[model samples]
Target: MSEINKVKVFRVQGTGPTPVTVKISRIGKALRIKCDCPAGAYMDPCEHWKSLFTGEDQNYLDITDDEIREIQDWLDDSDLDEALQNLLYFEGHEKNMHENLARQKRALRGRVIDILISDPQL
Candidate 1:
């Protein structure tokens, strides 16, 4: 069978923290499922995938193409936000160069500290 490369988006509703977005793509007979939750962050198959592929339950609703576009737009906007943040961190005028660099360094250090504090592996 020919593989359809188009991705299908779905929202899984459950009694968990919040609804999770799942994207599935089919290549041949194999299905690649991805989710936005922490479990999916490491590219692990999530509950959303189990339900769809394991035939346990169909807990997800297929989302429209417009909804997918909106999600993509939001992700693009987040990239823009990160770019703006980097500009504030590293591209300031020379007059406040030291201060700006220091501030950015502090922000990064804080992130490291936070991760270390919360991460089980640390």
Candidate 2:
């Protein structure tokens, strides 16, 4: 017989009054995440947050929790095609920065899936 064990999950929650929060929880054999940003709610990575995490680009933009929520709301209402276009734009922008083409491709695919779930039309 197999015994069930609990897995510990880590998350990166944004700072400031309106911060972007990433909550990672274990679901079955995979990890589930919930984000407070527009792209986050869609489970898609936001360029701003990604930049902060990866240090790929810096815009010096201070994102508040409210702003993150607002962005999530907007994303919830955005069209699928538009969301995909936005994702593709980000992927293209990141192409040159990532040295590993395979990693970049995987990242792009994940982003596309997130976008599709958020907006199936795309």
Candidate 3:
């Protein structure tokens, strides 16, 4: 018998607080990578896994399971109303933010707007 299941988590250092979780499972003689970030949302291998496997200088911070779980739990329980309010309050501040970060924030704001408009419970 060989190691068949493993999990690793890392904090991607960037404009936003991004934590990526990687799960590797073995079946027969092959290993697979699974991640839960936007780049991996489609259930395919993502850049995070690629960087780890390739030993590239991705400049990410290694994190423990507890830290990742704390972030994940917060995301899971996030309140849409509060999130929208915060985004609206800081809407124009993106002018002073980094270009890539501002773009990500804008994209997230747009998605939240769409969700709010379409959600029947709201």
Candidate 4:
């Protein structure tokens, strides 16, 4: 059996008032897994979502199992960011890679702003 066919299950903590537990199970020939999140059922798994299943941090929202499988398929077939972008769209969110990058750049600029604001002569 291929690695994709192997069954993998993960328990993730939720961020709600009551921490939620998520379970992911790998399904077929593709490196797809099934998730127990409400959104997980409709969307593919993302690295963040996969992290949830792999005992990583709980930064991802709940998703469905089939969606996890689809994500796995995309990951296997495409680049990481491409797969992620596709997965993001599946979750009703648009991937703003450029925007995020710009935000990071702006944050870096803040250091310059601080230096300028703190006048040495003042």
Q: List model 1 lDDT by residue over 6-122, tens digit each.
A: 567778876577888887664443445578888899976566655442235545666654654544333223423354336434534553877878999999999999999999998
Q: What is the C-alpha local distance difference test score of candidate 2?
A: 0.50
Ranking by lDDT: 1, 3, 4, 2
Order of candidates by TM-score, top first? 1, 3, 4, 2
- CA lDDT scores, all candidates in order: 0.60, 0.50, 0.54, 0.52
Estimated TM-score for each candidate? 0.42, 0.31, 0.37, 0.36
Candidate with the greatest lDDT versus the true structure? 1
Each candidate structure's count of clashing pairs: 0, 6, 0, 11
| Residue 4 miss distance in model 1 (angstroms) | 2.5
- Which ranges of candidate 2 are over 4 A from the true structure? 1-17, 47-94, 97-122
Model 4 alpha-carbon drift over 4 Å, by segment:
1-4, 17-29, 44-48, 52-56, 59-122
**Per-residue lDDT of candidate 3, residues 1-122 (tens digit):** 55333344455654347666665443333444567777678865455654443344555677654644443333222343355336544643664567778789999999999999999998
Question: Ten residues in a row with the worst lDDT in model 2?
Answer: 2-11
Best by TM-score: 1
Candidate achieving higher lDDT, 2 or 3:
3
Model 4, residue 27: distance off in Å is 6.5
